[model samples]
Target: MTTTLEQTAMPEAEADQVRAVLEYYWAKEWTDGLPVVPVTEGYLAEFLAEVDRDPDEVLFSITHLNRHLTVRLAAINAAMAGCRPEYFPVVVAAWEAIAKEPHPARGIWQSTTGTAPFLVVNGPIRGEIGLNSQGNIFGSGFRANATIGRAIRLALINVFGLHPHKLDQATQGTPAKYSACIAENEEQSPWAPLHTEYGFEPTDSVVTAYVIRSVMHIEARHTMDPEQLALDFVDTIRRTGSLIHEYTSALLVLVPEHAEVFAAAGWSKEDLRDFVFEHATRPRSELVAVGKDALSHKTRWRLSSDHPDSMPDTAAASDDPDTVRVLSHRSSIQIMVAGANNAGVSAVVEVFTLNPPREFPFSYSRIERAGH
Candidate 1:
């Protein structure tokens, strides 16, 4: 995990050789439409040294694509993404978490929804590797966050062969495809860190991976009331374009200021989730209006007066077919605190729902540093 590369022999190359290397990667489509750092033996060795596992260890494999993401290949991509050697462990952890996903993740990369692998890093590793949890957490500037995420994307392109129009059939891709890694703003958060909610200790470094379709920014600066903020989030979640299926989930990235307002109002994350699940409804008629009525009934969570057992306490709420809840369960909504406290801005990342419904939609892997 150390940055020192004293053991590796990194020889300086001529200007022509550097240009040729860049051209070679571009021609081979190994890059993500950006200039990549040449993956030399020296750089690869430095990255590989940070991981304790075998270099040929298969972290994950896409059987259809006939590709296996080995530890050695991951290090090569991490180096090409301009990641520091110290950041290699986090990258490795991300792939491990992705590999644990219950759904066929290859579909997530190749689906027409244009979904991207959204990563959330928690615990001590955030500060250890200079990951940004504050101010422009999703934007450019932080090298660790940018490159670690980019490394995964590069592996998807080169190793999995998920190029734009070929295996990846994303109609219109999202900008998050470039890089979508962020650390939890634990210091500024009102609730426990995200990993803790999944039974991980606060002391342990962990990486959580989710396949997300798009990021919808929520602005509630005008309101200080927790209910009002919840209403705003409900509006964003219940939007027609945001609704991919009947049983949808979302990652609510709350800024410190907004989370503080909720905390002050004695609203926990569970309370917010309940509130969102109860209020984020759009009626089946609206879906019909949007030409989604046919697809709505295909889900197991579809509610109707005839199927009272579909949802809990069906008699208590409106039994009308129009009363369609956007989220399947209260547990579907995951709230995490991130971003600077400068604004009341927050984000709602729509999670990709698998057809069969994955037993575990999100996967977490503990970050293991070199030697340990």
Candidate 2:
């Protein structure tokens, strides 16, 4: 639902009080209102042993804060999110991914664009953690999916002090700020998991987080001409101009049902990317149909003032399509074959951009499940 800001500064307290302290830090406004498991010293110690990072070491530094999230804080939030003791490692890794300096945390943490970051779990760990990658993957009811995502948000608030309407100035916050997570249907996926695409191995577990401004559904029957279906899909997005966001481009998550329509014809994720990049593009003139003054410059983005006339209307909005690239950067379009038992159509996970991706101490990582 809605997460408000946590209570004002809490002074130092005894060891036993830490749990109550975090809960208070979480409850007054830090949380999405779900009950949280307390993060105790013992829990933090256990996570540290696994990750083996210096407690004071800067695992990540937020550009928006004077504070840096310690391994202890990440662990505490992970614990609060009901992560298994072993899951702390994964939590830490996800933090590293989002905290990457260029990952775009600063501007996104406080943007009027009203977007929220979503964590996607890929690789073999999906089944180990019991994530729902197959049916209703994006829906609620999965422990790992829910908690891992929430753990990061908690870290953002408790660690970086980004609360609603204060530093995080969104007119209408999204559900992802509460909990947004999902796993890849690796068993059913035809291509390499996203982690592998980003450099991790198939055997390795990885977490990837991106700012998704909004999500939309792609409704189409399994047509004989999948390319034709794709054209319609592009047209669908073009009409709304969501792809032409003043801030960034939109994300399109393709489900298995829809993927197979292309697969039957042997169309790979790359094929989809190529097809989309080739056919789903708009001219600069067309992209700025709403005009250029729509977007504001973000500090997190490494943009050049070189193009004063890329589009008649884009001078002030944005110039670097690379930062906001949608269909081109194989990294931009994450294709996950998931959703529902029976379906001719699939839901697209359109993760709207935050800025450029942040690169800091942390990167996508996963926990080693107990006994695994």
Candidate 3:
């Protein structure tokens, strides 16, 4: 059996009456504290037609709240977020990524730390839909980038009831919470596109979603030496507050300038990830100084209780703070290219750091084409 929302059409109101509709919805607290396009029956139907999917098909379920997300409701929220009908597929893919098992973003939406699911689009759809992967890629300007991300946020708010101060209790919410989506600059990338790296063909579209706690921007123009550049990035990771202490996902968005340096010197994406993972370290004493007890830190990394391997022989004997690995594993570091091809600038989108990662692990969903 299919589930469909009852046809709720707005009354025939002239342009002047638009304000009343907006005000009524706002007063009802149905918005994200922002103006939204009214989702009438006609508009919702138009969006659903683009996907040709069963409107009642359950995409994912918020079991705690007894809420099952359906395509029709997604279309309604997409329309309210001002998305074109064609954008619905990408929205569905993003939501599916977040709902994937072992990485479901159940608690992330309401965490005390301000975290938001940032979407990264790959493949032909990015160019087909005019998703920005160039200059100002992470900034505002592109309609597809803004509204597509906003559509997901709208679904969380209107459909799943993730309202602020209630389901979403972020203490100091970030501006990125509104919409943080961008496409990878595959054309400018020195290596393969993200989808290709994930084993998808070049033509297949893909979307990845992760709950980013914060971002760290890096500028590597001071020196062209590869070792020096890697040191700069490794130090940044070492100093940054990682949500998880070990073997977790961290995204590095390398710009053309930084990527070119590695490409010219014969360094692949794996090379970069490995180098950073090896160098991103601190002494066990450093963790102790930060109030992370040595015993817990060892357990966090799964080190042997009797023979901890994180600390160097000298550091362990002397209680020095210069011999522990900060980043957990090499495979957890993901690399992508974006931004203008000019300066040595980059950004790191960090994931949450739970000792025992319960929710919000890195997730990816392939974007399905209509009629495929």
Candidate 4:
């Protein structure tokens, strides 16, 4: 069956000028509560040529709904998000990453918790496209970071019908739903780039997508010792409201200064992960007190099976719910470096667990230039 946009007439909105076009889309509820750049056949055609991809070429399919997003439609969304043709490839790669079933992004899109995909870029394309890797990387100002991320949200709305109160059921959506993209500060990172850790070549560009619900920024300037620095992160991750017992995944984005602490002591990313996994815990009694018993035994079991050495000290006394250890596995933690150098500031973005019947694993996709 034909699934590409090329086989159908393009949707049109009448307008005489750019302002009219923005107003039209805003009125039609086709935008993310913000004005969108006007799209035209002429502009979209130019964007299509950037990758030389067929308008009908299907990049990915949303398995649950049997929906396909074609290259032409993606370009249209890219243009609508104010992305230039050169930024189209990164957009495609981000979509390809989420489109996979392994990533299970559709669950994230439809959930009431309102999770958004956090895109992290690596390699030459980061510098080439001017993606933000430092100094308010998560904040606004940069065109490439903002628009590249916005393009993905637009594609989700236009192609997948994730419209608010329609397909999207976010109870309290976050501002991140608008746009969230950042590049790795590879030159400043103490360890290899994220993509490299995933086994990609250093020179290759890649986009790693995480379904995140919230961000927690922390400052750890009290001590320069690597272990002490790790304790600070452990404390932050174990916050009472974080639902630690139902742990899914956590991403630690270290600023250059914080990363340098570990690098100077010859600590690898793995060391930090191990440290966080060991120390980032809360009392099981707290979970039961807060009506989280379902997580109590199961999580303890998983922790023992996954990291026996790090298992809670009170496992022999299962009823002693006061025993701490919410984060069950080291694999649930991911590490990377971003933000400006010379500050103890860093952030942790958490990807919460999905409700019953829709667990999707974290995933990554390499960003290959269209011609490459």
Candidate 5:
């Protein structure tokens, strides 16, 4: 359940040895289709020293794979992913959150849907570690955002053996599968940070994980009207391809400009969620046209049997069958402000799993710094 690394200093390997190590990793498919940092005992020790927990401590386990991710292994992957020693806690916290997912952890990683673990970091640690929450936040130019996400992927491949075309059977994975991590632009936001909505303190450093199938950008620059912007978001969320399941949910990443628009209209995050929930609907005839009506029937059955008390009676009472709501509940829509204020750009991340467990899509864990 634990892996201990040798604490002795390791001299730098010669050029030949370094080349051999890289060759070995590539041949063994240990690398994520890219050259790794060539993790040495000395490099590993630096990362281990930054964590208070035992190196051998099992952060989480995938029972089906017979795999256990110990702190030492996590550090190894983190080091290989080019992470600084200080970044270890955030990486560890990410895996901790993934372990708490309601669905089988294996399914989340190995689903045919090509879903990836999307991480949203909040709290003071964003500044402490130089996470990019501003311009090109989702793209590149930030080490913490890039490697923290890569560390998780490396662990899944190296430790759990969820290698592509093998244990991990993804059908045309998105580029985000390589790295999908971002910090909330809490400073520019007009509302509370994401962690606070989960009852975490404003100062609590936290990482939230969601299984996302796709990250679609919504560009609505023409309007200052919040309702018009809401319509653009609604259209993206109600796209037929994204409606694979009736209980699907969405994480709307609003740019600061859009956030300001909502704030100016006296709209809270709740108001935005309510608006999306009420309007992001498709007529039953559309679902029938798209062959999703059977799935909708299944959703109705599940709602009636599993959550009769919380069923949408208003939608059910309507004589017209065209009143089908895409999201199962008002709580299904999550809004967070991120990206730059310059462009009228935002992103809508499609959640991978249906919400029968209701909390199927997300899990959160606090980041515990070493010295603090």
Candidate 6:
């Protein structure tokens, strides 16, 4: 009797087929690892309908590939990221911010430094979109938080061409890559939302980009005295161990709990800034070990206003083993935003974007245009 050839099961065959296709494409270096939903006209068109942006409009173009993302391409990335159509504007805005030259997208993504972008949102849309800022905000479970974060990461990967092991040389990237979107928790914040602090109107939506290594919490319950609170900040900064590049910017997020303490003590934003400035100085010697040496020539062993022209200089090739703690001008703190609802605890995250002194006014991005 003629033996019939064994047939592959349909489901098994389908799985194998998909796997084979993925392997072939990836082996040829065609994939970003995460299986991208086919960004077809149909799939992207629906996203466009929600945002109602012009397909030809250039939103943001990231380096080399100079992937100039139009509304349609952003929609494709947004759809694949599982974002609500309304989230499209936020996604585009963030992309534009990171792509702006100083954002260091090329350096941030490609450097062995394990830094990643955090999308901090402000404006009325935060309340409208239900982005999380309360307890467990970083934890999974919030749709707005998840998708807004995903949209930006996908844009970086797809538009900026930061495929892992190729362009993105992160030594050990964090799970934040999946999504790191957080709102100002405006309703809960005692001060203005982040956008307003950054000079946007209360009704305007704005996104700020920062390259953060980790989110560190400075415990505020030690005491309610604002100076004591400022001292707590001093302790954290002195010990932070952030020897990043001179231009790296750190995010100081105030939790509502701690904000209340400062507010009750009648401290203005300038007061906190000045306190952080005074207590945050580090000996330049301690810095040489951690940073890229880009600004060592300019940093002082101990920064002082009276001694602005001269800093305690340490040689880059100095053989003296004990000169590592030179003090430099305390790079000013930046872009403060408050989060949480309880009003007792807050956070200060050391961002990797700022370093060196910048003289020009910094804008988060071209203000988010209302339309495309």
What is the per-residue lDDT of model 1 for residues 291-320, given as tens digits with 9 covering 90 to 100?
544342344333432443433323135556
Query: Would you estimate the TM-scores of all the predictions?
Result: 0.89, 0.76, 0.86, 0.84, 0.89, 0.75
* Pairs that collide, model 5: 2-56, 3-56
What TM value does model 6 have?
0.75
Name the runs in model 2 displaced over 4 angstroms.
1-30, 101-105, 243-250, 283-289, 292-331, 354-372
Per-residue error for 214 in candidate 4, Å, reads 0.5
User: What is every candidate's alpha-carbon RMSD to the true fold?
Assistant: 5.7, 8.0, 7.5, 8.7, 7.2, 8.3
Q: What 10-residue stretch in candidate 1 is worst by lDDT?
A: 307-316
Tens digits of per-residue lDDT for model 2, 131-219: 78777666788888888888888877776767776777888877777888887777765666667766777898878767666666777
lDDT of 3 by residue, 1-372 (tens): 655555645566665598888999898777777888987788787787777579999877777778778988888887877788888889889878878744333566777777887999999999888999988877888889989999888878877788888888899987778888999999998899877776899789999887777778987788777778878877767762552444345788989888888888999998898898887767665655654323334435433224444422222444554576655457567789999997788987776544554333467898875786
- Output the lDDT of residue 367, model 6: 31
Model 5: C-alpha RMSD to truth? 7.2
Model 6, span 1-372: residue lDDT tens: 655546434587877877786676556554345654445677676667665457878876655555677777677778767677777677777767765636463455666766677877777677777887776666788888888787767766776677788788888887777778887767755666666655578778787776667776776776878788877765665562554433323456777777767778887666776677655645444554443222333632223323435433343345753333211333346535455555456566666544343432133653343453
Local distance difference test, per candidate?
A: 0.84, 0.63, 0.76, 0.78, 0.84, 0.62
Prediction 5 TM-score vs. true: 0.89
Model 4: lowest-lDDT 10 consecutive positions: 300-309
For candidate 4, give the lDDT.
0.78
Error (Å) of candidate 1 at residue 82 is 0.6
